[model samples]
Target: MFNRKHLEAILITRTELRLPRTTPEAVGIRSTAIAALLDAWKESGLELHSMMILRHGQVAAEGWWAPYAPELSHMLFSLSKSFTSSAIGLAAAEGLLSLDDAVISFFPEVAPEEPSANLSAMRVRHLLMMGTGHEEDTMGPLSSAEDGDWVRAFLQVPVGREPGTHFVYNSGATYMLSAILQKVSGVKLLDYLRPRLLDPLGITEGTWESCPRGIHTGGWGLMLTTESIAKFGQLYLQRGVWEGKRILSEEWVNEATSKQIHNGDDEANDWTQGYGYQFWRCRNGAYRGDGAFGQFCIVLPEKDTVIALTSGTNDMQGVLNGIWTHLLPALTEDVTADPAAHEALSDKLGSLTLEPPVLDAASPLESEVSGSRYVLDENQFQWTALSVQFESQEAVVTLENCEGEFVLRCGRGEWAEGRGVLLQGAPFQRGANHRMASSFTWRDSETLSITLRYIETPFYVTSELKFNGDELTAQQQVNVAFFSPELPSLHGRRS
Candidate 1:
């Protein structure tokens, strides 16, 4: 049934029905409203990478910050959960599985000995709703176990309360959903959706990171371009029908997006509004699939619009707040044409860029530190040796660590792109293809500072190297960290 000819046919149909492009005024949205949203984002200190606004199934505005282009597939983090949930929906439609099925039924071999009553009552729907009954998140312990058998480890965890009685933001539960889908379908989550969802949607460049056992990481690690995310939202907005064909059953879409449980009592908090199957309901009668660091796919049925964005900011709520304040009120029922506003908004979107690090004249200290090897005492980073070489416009820094010799070329003021692996420290490890944009500046006559930004991820590291006569000290700090608020500084001395 999964043949090349069928996949090609689906792709052709998707291209024929590709989302139309139009001016904001052609839709009911005012161009000035989008401009105001951008202004609000900047004022909120949010670092935006890319965004696309759609109205009436047509793209009204889309742009990417310089260095982060529209073609690049950004890491979606937990936004991947929405796609995984879709895969389960497809499997159910095919009669391969049912939402009421006991999760343990799919993995008899991994089932715990004498499963607890709570575990026994756990259903697939419970996993979908984050109602696993575990008081706290189980991903930490389940992922850290040495055996690397995530299924077995998760099953062994004590289900403290009856299934569906409570809600905990459990990523492991989503992972279990992926594992169950794979168990029944005999394929990974991504593969299962390739022909059924992605091909039909014309998303050709989707990828998902796999665990040690080669299973797709359902709760995280999916990558897609901004337009692809917008397409997914548009599909859900159309009630699972793309063009004339029904890609997903309308019944499934309604159930998946409807609030399944009460997540919190605070009505003021957006996250407390409600939660569906891997979808978060908003106060304005909308829902979204979002990830860490502000990756969002918002579906606004009331406005006949969808907004997709990828960002590297800690204040995710701030992004949503900007949307509600700036974009929500602008969605009118009738198109309002303002050529001046459209031109201004177009110019601003075309010129969007992240500010580069400041550059200053080379210091006299450069002559003293040029090609100097710094030998260090024991430090938290375990960096053994370091060297710096000054060039006309950039500095080349080399360091020896447990992983081996690593080199980074830092631009004087601009962002210089380089590929390498950033060691695991703050939260998680990245792939070798990870790209970092680096900049260097002389903080003073005696101090040199360098900033390395993993553009694909949210965090950035700032290193300060201070020189006092022949002695040198190095300190590293993270702008925002996941596991810890503050990281220990590494100390070193020049030999």
Candidate 2:
């Protein structure tokens, strides 16, 4: 359980060493370069939600797209691994456990009756470095276990090679680390880190999703604001010291950020540089904690800078490339203010909006089919029927599935906010009530396209409804899908 008094103290620290705001030009950076980066990202079709650039312990530039604000806690996905690693570091510093300790020792009861030689040899360090001997990721098998005993199921999987000799990206390994922390600390990972980390850095509003067993999902499902992420990166930049107090030991920081495994060798890309404990080495002599679809906490040691961003984009690498290409070159040794360029950049940032899909003139078929219900053919989504009703400025789509009716409101050429589900009982939705923004456009005389964006998450669904007399065919696609982008097509007859 979290203490309210401790939380209040943490909130008070928000003012102690709050990052001061300044223009990019004042921090020896060219504002035009930041603009160029934004333009490049927009051109490449990357949907950026928010960004914050910090230099010399001050924020140089910050912006959030309209729907994404500064206060909202955006999901950090795998970036949560870095924070989990921090918890382990804190625990190790307190002498609660050692990195060399055999993982089986923590959960003796859950250990196999006769543990395999490779499994018995596995250590906490192997899990940190993603070197847990398993040739393939274990998350799938662990998740599939009927009993949901994740720890036991993880141990049951054969460790094909000796621990610390192989690297396979495994979220299950990180989950084990979280389980170990909970076992040793006698509390959840978040509670353990509250006083040691979040409070000290003034990061009061953050949440980590938990597994069915109540352990924090260590590899993913962390949520924080962009500033919180920047603060985290800045802590690493200052060698784990925050507000002149050492929160994490310098020794732990060194080990955590240093290359623990050789992941890839492609010199052109940041991800190919190498892998730290939970960080990825970048080409421009930096390291970062990143999540799928571009949640980044980048630390540039050589440049004395930290950057944080949250985005819903497929080209995560492109965001990094833009930073390296545009922002890196702009950092200079001496501070030189370019007021005009700064003003222009600020203006551009303030005006940023994700352009909604454009809608053509109302379809000639609108009047005939506007209020008609269509009975849909059997589909994987289990949607039984759908109907479209167009008003003067917006359209309403009502869909019925196994979960019941969902009325999605869509603007003609804008985003209209509503409460609805893209697909009810979707595994990716995680049972959370959806707050969505939807828009619709006519692709042609017979085709109507709709985009539904889950405002709180990094995914969206696009559906195309084609009309041919009394017959309709609907196709759905997701922007960033977990398994497959393709959704089942629904053939329907007007009723």
lDDT of each: 0.85, 0.85
lDDT of 1 by residue, 180-288 (tens): 9898999999999999999888888888877778889799989888888999999999999997889999999999999998899887677988789999988799999
Candidate 2 residue-wise lDDT, 260-377, digit = tens? 9878778887877778788888887899999988999999999999999999888898999899989999888675778888999998877666656886847888888898999998
Q: After superposition, how far is residue 67 of candidate 1 from its true place, in Å?
A: 2.5
Local distance difference test, candidate 2: 0.85
Looking at candidate 1, what is the lDDT of residue 89? 95
The deviation in Å at residue 99 for candidate 2 is 0.9
| TM-score of every prediction relative to native | 0.93, 0.92
lDDT of 2 at 199: 85
Question: Which pairs in model 1 have colliding backbones?
Answer: none
